[model samples]
Target: MKRTLHTVWLVARRELRTRVQTRAFVLGTLFMALLVLAFPVVTLFAGASNAPEDELSASDSTTRLGITQSANGLADPLERKAGVDRPAISVRKVADTETGKNLVREGELDGVVAGTPTAPELFVERHVFPHLERALTTITYNNQLDAEMSRSGLDPEAVRDRAGRGEVAIVSMGESQGAADGPMAGISDAEKAQRLIIAMISTFLLYMFLIMTGQMISQGVVEEKSSRVVEVLLSTIRSTELMAGKIVGIGLTGLIQFAVIGVLGFTAATATAVLTLPTFTVAGLLGWAVLWFLLGFTLYATMLAAASSLVSRQEDLQSVITPVIMLLIVPFFVGVSVLPTNPDGTTGTVLSMIPGFSPMLMPMRLALGGVPLWQGALSVVLSLVASAAVLWLGGRIYSNAVLRTGARVRLKDALRAS
Candidate 1:
């Protein structure tokens, strides 16, 4: 047992050292790390820039002030006030109502506020953005309410006090309802959005990294076989040990890179409060991502390793492994795209349970804090079992085909070899 492990370690360590020293590996790893660091930062900035914008042309300065400065000048709060996303609005006073209407009709402005504060008429052909309409209604109603309050002999302070009293607090109770207890529970809308995006991005990374890394492993097989390196290594170590070592070595490199990306990206995002819910925790999701990455690599790397053994030359590599690549890539995209909206939905749940898809799907579900303990456990077990089976199969293929140097060895011939 020790000898086998030592041989595996020797092979793994050599591969790791060799790859790490390469300029391509170093540069690529650095590039991916930078991307991870940039993802959340870019996401936050993009959200700010992408907020819906509404431009309203008012009749005059007074009307524009009424629209923007109503509700005790509480129309625009730069910070998130009550967890709802607010759009950006700019109000400009025009020379006349007709001009404002023209601007609106010509698409220069979103709408025109022409009538009085009490009975303000928002003139627009179509209400494309709801935020504009809400802003108009809110300002108009506040101005009207203030007028009614003034008529009732309440001073500005008293009107403010009354309005303050009208602002009822909203309490989100999920404990009793059982709606918020899972991944989505107790998290703010911002947090939910962030989790979804993070999950999606992580899924993308997994897909990108796994497929690339698996391809590298396959290419390594072809390279070693074509160059007759495997024959030399075969004299000293068992094929199983060599195969195990290569997978482990390559997997470790990928894991380290993955860890750096996940940890740094997640930490930066959380620190920036990019999608922070009150109960937004990172450790759990981090573990989930790393675990799935390992499992995903196991399933893919082994199968790809076995597939590569079918072809001796590097050029014949693509044809042999294309199906395997597609099998993993397709599910990864689907899991990332669809799981966020319905983390606990039927499609996600089923996919997460299946072996090939589980590696990607379950992590997405985990990222959203939506996966049940049982589901996660089952996924891990299934993936591990599948990985073991594939690894065994791959070892057999590698052992059988690694010695063959001609055209691609048929699967039947490889399996029948002693």
Candidate 2:
């Protein structure tokens, strides 16, 4: 037992060392870290383009405009009327209508308002600013409505009081507001983006790390067979020991890389949260991401290591391992495309319970705050059990077939090999 334990550690250590020393591993880790950091930075700048400007301006930034005396009445009396403060305009009385029109044309005035109190007209060089037009129309209506109402023998103040009192307080009911006041209605685009970013980044990295390390282990196994490295290693340790050591070694290396990227992503999420980009609580999502990454890596890496032993030549690697890669990839796209909108929907619920897929899908659902503790715990337990079964089968296939060479060895033949 002691010798076997020592051999596994030896193999794990060798694989970890060999992987870290490579230029590709070191550079790839940094590149992925930078990619994680870039997400929030891009999000920050992207929102600015859609933001409203701080200062509102119109007609060369002047708030003062001219009002002309019309055929029916002058605009002066309504200019100082009470109880109106919206769309503020400073009115200047113009003696001559044609002079006011020329002032607007000469850019000395914003525009000239000329007409009866009931029907007002604003003249600018070519066109009036839309907001200015609306404001002029509203103020004119208010001024004319009161006078018009008084002339009809109605009490204007009493009518105003009745109109203002008609406003009803709307309670947040689904049918009442057309979903405007629902529980989910308050979520901003940034919050939605953050939720998606968390879900996607977690699932995507899991897929990448699992597949990359899995292929590395497959390649390592084939290298051992082709270069007769297994014969030399076997002299000191049994085949199972060598296989155990190599998988553990490569897995530890993959875990370290995964952790680095996860930490960077978690940090970016924290910072983005300050900018109002909501994330799952740092401890909650970060912990699950790391947990799922390790579990996902273990399950896939074991199968990939076993699959590698079936093929002696590098050219045959893709044919044997493509299915395992697809298993990791399918759940990733599902989590990314479907999980955000329907975290607890039919797809997420079913996929999160599956052993292979749960590793990628559950962490996303967890961030969406849809999965309960029992469900997540159940998924983890199933994954561990699945990992154990895969490990046992992987150990057998690899131990039997790692020594064989030439054409690809079939799984059934390898399992039955004496």
Candidate 3:
């Protein structure tokens, strides 16, 4: 047993050294790290550019109006009706109707109030602002109503006071309930949005990592078999050990790249203030992502290596490994398309607990925050169980088929081989 472990370790070390020292691995890692670092910086500048425009719009919200002598009495009422919620009304007295019209046309004012308080006429350069128009209309209507009430021997001020007091009481059930104590409790809308972003990013990275590493494992196996390298290696180490060592070595390489990218992305996002999540929260998400990757890579890599061993040439490797690739692809599309809008929906919740789907879906739910502890624990357990079974079965197929060269060996023949 000790000798077997020593052989596996030696092979793992050799594979790791070969992969890490490759030009492709070094350049790919550097490029991905740079890209991750640049994302937050780009977002920060884009937001910065649009911020000034928003501030300018808010600072210049006052509506300027000109009033002629005929409508001079309406000024106080209009000011009062404008209220604090609507835009502030800036009233200027004009000499005559023509002067007010000229002021509006010259862009010096938003609108002109002429005629009389009860029969006011508004002139504007183009369209009147909605709030300003509403205020003017309300003031005119009140004046006419007040005059009618006075004619009828009713107190207009007393009537207004009673009407003002008859406001509809608003009772919001959502607000009254306060924050929920269950999953998704107490999370603000902004935080939810941030969680969704984190979920999406996690899903994408896992998908890419799985695809890249799965292919690497399959191709590496086929390359060794085709070139008779496995024959030489097998003479020294058992087939199972060779397969185990390759999976470990390639997995570690992928893990290194994955960690570098994740750390760089989080660091950049935090430094640029793009992500408002606490450091521990971000770190926890990253930790979950790493865990899922290791589990996913193990389960898929074993099957892919076993599949590739059936074929001696790289050309036929795709036919054998396409099904495993599809397994990775289906969950990726499902999670990315469904989870963003409905992270806690029944479909995601259930699928995330399944072995094949969990690695891709569970991490997304966890990153979105509010996933129950049982669900996360169950998914991990199921995946580990599935991986162990696959590893055992895949080891048999690879051991029987890897040394067989020439035309593609059927899976049944490989499994049934002595």
Best by TM-score: 3
Candidate 2 Cα errors over 4 Å, as ranges: 52-192, 272-280
lDDT tens per residue, model 2, 1-418: 9878987898889899989999999999989989988876776556445532112231134445687767224344434431132234567888867988888778778678787677777787655355566555667778689999999999999999999987654332111233223234444344456656666767777778888888898899888888888888878788888878887898888889888888777777466532333232545566777788778877888898889889888889999899888888888877778877777688778889799889888888765543555788889999999999999998899888888888899999989986
Candidate 1: minimum summed lDDT over ten consecutive residues — where? 54-63
Model 1 residue 268 CA deviation in Å: 2.2
The local distance difference test score of each candidate is 0.73, 0.73, 0.83
* Worst ten in a row by lDDT for model 3: 172-181
lDDT of 2: 0.73
* True lDDT of residue 94, candidate 2: 89
Number of the top lDDT candidate: 3
Candidate 1 Cα misplacement greater than 4 A, ranges:
50-185, 277-280
Question: Which TM-score value belongs to model 2?
Answer: 0.66
TM-score of each: 0.69, 0.66, 0.69
- C-alpha displacement of 11 in model 3, angstroms? 1.2
> Higher lDDT: candidate 1 or 3?
3
* Runs off by more than 4 Å, candidate 3: 51-183
